[model samples]
Target: MNIKKYILSFFLLISLSLFSQEVAEKRDAPKPEIKISYLDSIKKTFVRDDLASCVDSLWLKELTDLDLYNNLSQDIQTINFDEQVDYELPTEVLKARLQEMDEKSPFHIEYNPGLENIIKSFLKNRKRAFERLMAISEYYFPLFEEALDKQNVPLEIKYLAVVESALNPKAVSRVGATGLWQFMYQTGKQYGLKIDSYVDERSDPLKASEAAAQYMKNMYAIFGDWDLVLASYNSGPGNVAKAIRRSGGQQNYWNIRKNLPKETQGYVPAFLATMYIYEYHKEHGIKPERAPIKHFATDTVMIKKQISFKQISDLIDIPIAQLQILNPSFKLNIVPSYKDQAHYLRLPQDKMAVFTSNESKIYAYVDREANLREKPFQIVRPIVPQDSINTLQRLAQAKVRYYRVKRGDNLTTIAQKYDVAIEDLKKWNNIKGNKVAYGKNLRINGTDVEQKLSAVAKVEVDKKAVIKDSLGSKMDSFYVVQKGDNLSAIAKKFNISVADLQEWNKLTNNNIQLGASLQIAKNSIKEDVVAAPERKDIQYVVQKGDNLGNIAKKFGVSLDDLKQWNNLTTNSIALGSTLIVAKNEIAIVTNKAPVASFKKKEEYSAPATEYYVKKGDSLYSISKKYPGVTISDLKKWNNIKDEELKPGMKLKING
Candidate 1:
């Protein structure tokens, strides 16, 4: 689970954020009653005015860069789907299956050699991609279903977004179509979607799904056929009309298929293929890799005042990237509060109460920040880590060897076996004292080699490692005093007498600076078995829904250690905003890993084809272009020694 949902799930057990002084209301404050559902509520909020009248020069001025790089929807639009994939399923089996699907679906689903090619192409080339797509679909499909139902569009029409934007809300097309439903500027405006300096309803998942449904309804009114409505949606009704007329007034989409635009011809087939793959992916052994958070796990709230994502992130301890993902329509990263209209901040369902209670403090922080600034509001962007790339890259780049711990094998044995020093193994694996846990991976290295392999994960960082008193009687290891820490706890943590601590630091009283660092003697550290925290404090403030045990494990500390350090008698911990994860602030890592197997993707493979590299091509790009092809394969195939690539370079791909 992500911090968002993980915190959310802890609501019944504890309300972490609300307990802080920053929050305004009572502990058991009454939750504001939601009178109506979100689906019903949105219909009343949509504007009746034409979109063009609402847009102005300022709207164009705030335009951001096109986020089209590496988008699936863009690739599909330009690529020839018919030629991209191949399948050897018997024609009779496919025809029979399609015939069955046609009976149930409102859109045309009859067997065509053209449709067959696309379906097989997806199965052959996009099994892994589709599996991941299906995972993402979980978060979106529900909202699409609700919005589509509200607009009276077919539920199956939800699949259209897969083809339009691959369910990516921020997706922008080369032709300037934008959002999950790929609405053009004019069309988006025409459909009453708000677009301006601070907002783009086109990228709003719920709003866009609603608009797409309404658009489909209008198109159906013109063509009286769902298939033509889809074709009209892509190529426009005028083009569909031209195609119909050119096909001798044929009402059937297949009969008029030849007359439609090139993209529209493939668009309908891609949509159908998506629907088929989602429905029968299990038969193909493709399994969904679930999204980080489910849609139902989230909820939305109207902000009475304007608020920036940074403020919410700062106050709630949720990542700004996560906030943006949950609420993508906010163009300027600010949720503006309109006097006459309502604008909401969507968050995990459990955070609604916490946000409502602390709404005043959040606004006050914004005011204080504004008042403190000598100039106009400046972007004090937080230094967030680039976590999209996996840590496996770090492990791969460390050029290190690993050995699984066996029974009765201590760090000394492993160090000796690898011909490395004992202290090197301790520092390398973040081990404390001489104790190494059984069934764990340890890094063995020589003292000449530098330790600390860029740290560990939310799965836990080894911080409790006992640094021995290399000086014997003198203090050798240091314990930087953290906030809420006292002399008593520090001595207990280091297994040293408080008198010794006071003597070494020359302190008369327990009072210490929050920023002060104190040296600790290794004394009896040989018996110490846990790691400790370090500088660059990675404190995670408990959100509304968080569990202490999970937090403890994530930070690589024992649950008992956390309670003891915090002086807690009960199971409650979120007394303050800072989570106090470790002495060293750990990098935020997503719990959702990439899907390794949709029933083990290794079990399936498509036939590979050769390709020539185009301008701006690299080995990585080429590998991404073809599923099941890795950069390693490219190096071996071309016999290249390095990552250098030039135009007109020939490479082989094997799936």
Candidate 2:
């Protein structure tokens, strides 16, 4: 080697090593010293080993919606490992590999035809899937290892999770076993994993790993044999004991394997096969698929208030699918707060500050639209004043009180109940038509007759208001025209035809105005209006190709509204089961979705500047913040493609 060239090469390697160890400090100033091109070079040269050694695998560059929504269930990536073994491999090669693995492990090392068959089947048929799982294992293995170390279980047991779940945290078996460790509901509870309406801790990575480790520790004490322990984990200890007894008290797994359950007979072999493939993938020329994100990139925070995954995703600009991947325990995409139960979220470490800083704002977004459910999985904002006295409807003499617009509420019915004219109901709330928005507060009895009423008039007004309040609940299936609502849009919302809407309302034209109530159901305007219509529960049976979203759409209700009405904590509804869609068509009206707010405009002297994304900042929002910047420019400058925006992400903005 040339002396001068070799010395320069050595210095370059040292510089890269030093850069990797240094913590990346976020730039708060107007300009960033690290240019995009320079960062790209560092990424290529270092292969991200500088950031953290725990996650140095090649990253899957495209974080598309498909990848975001991909779980073990979708492609049956986990099932391949669970299926019965029926293939053969060269006996010598299989025995040699098994001996090496078994010698390192505390488990029995003997190889049978069963283990060879599984290893052959997995390598032949499930090579691609197993490779991808190995990639995913980069993030989970660290967590499993930590749990195993704490529990004093052998590190080799970490391969058990890979066999059980293919490293998918959200994996659920047909037998109702859940999570990476594949714990049954009863076993999960016994192991201290929480299972409830709002959260299922079995799918939580950190907690589930700990529970699995503890369970493994306990099982080893019972069986005293690793192979038998693996078999017991698949079926149950009782069955394993029965198998041993049937085999005439044989202590060896292979000796008792013939007497075990059909599934359990193959379980231990399958686990050993997984261990073999994971250990020897390099020799087989199987390349692990690139991981989407690393282990160290994520951090957690205990949520202070109840919030939905959609709400957080909207505010932080992360996709809901990614949120589910990070926090699988939230049963309904809702991180609920029940007493002292701790529910939290795991997000990208960079976005941790973004979430913590805007925790109040995110909760406020939910609070403002708590009852104004507009659409499923969409952020809805209700137009409400600060409830200030100045914003209150100013009536001359009549006292003002807000009445929540319920299902079947129309101006005509409200007027009759309040003993006021239809025009008066519209005039008090600054309405353009005779319709009232559901879930919006209406200022009733705002019409003033006299400046100062005598005791007799006041008493009459009081009596009439009392009667109106009593008759508040109506059975009319009415929908109020909201801002930007056209006849066709309104029809779509109610799952009715545009012609049907026009015919029902007896409209001469397709034109509609805000606050104009239109009767939706055919019998909403019956000839004889009864005092209290019997509120029959409208139940919908789960059908094929039905989900909570589409079912909600079929009933013309928001997804959140559907979940709330049924007290459903998750989207997993069973087929052929009846769900309470609505009660008398009473509480299932949709509202308007809100547009996100814009950021403050700051003057920039530099032609190019670095912008750190904040909560609720979208590409469009960023474009608007900078005068000359456009969405196209932002995407091009930052190489953002199919992936959605995430908080605390750095963007290069050009003016």
Off by over 4 Å in 1: 1-71, 78-88, 375-655
Best by lDDT: 1
lDDT of each: 0.66, 0.65
Per-residue error at 190 for model 2, in Å?
A: 1.8
Candidates' TM-scores? 0.47, 0.49
Which candidate number would show the highest TM-score if scored against the true structure?
Answer: 2
lDDT of 2 by residue, 1-655 (tens): 5999999999999998877666343333356476554323422432111132122213422221223224423332333434556544567887888888777889887776556656777777678767777777877889989999998998888988866776666767777888878889999998888887778999998999999888888889998988888888887889999989998999899899889877776677777777888898887778997676777789899987778887776666566767777788888999986554677789877566667766666666677657566532211211211111111111111144456667798888878876788887787688997677765657665333122112112222223333344666323345556678898876655556888888888999998876677766543222222122112344555757879987776555688887888888999999988787654421111111111111212332334568898766678656644433467878887888854888899888653
Instruction: Estimate the TM-score for candidate 1.
Output: 0.47
Model 1: residue 231 alpha-carbon error in angstroms: 0.6
- Once model 2 is optimally superposed onto the true structure by TM-score, how far is the C-alpha of residue 437 displaced, in angstroms? 32
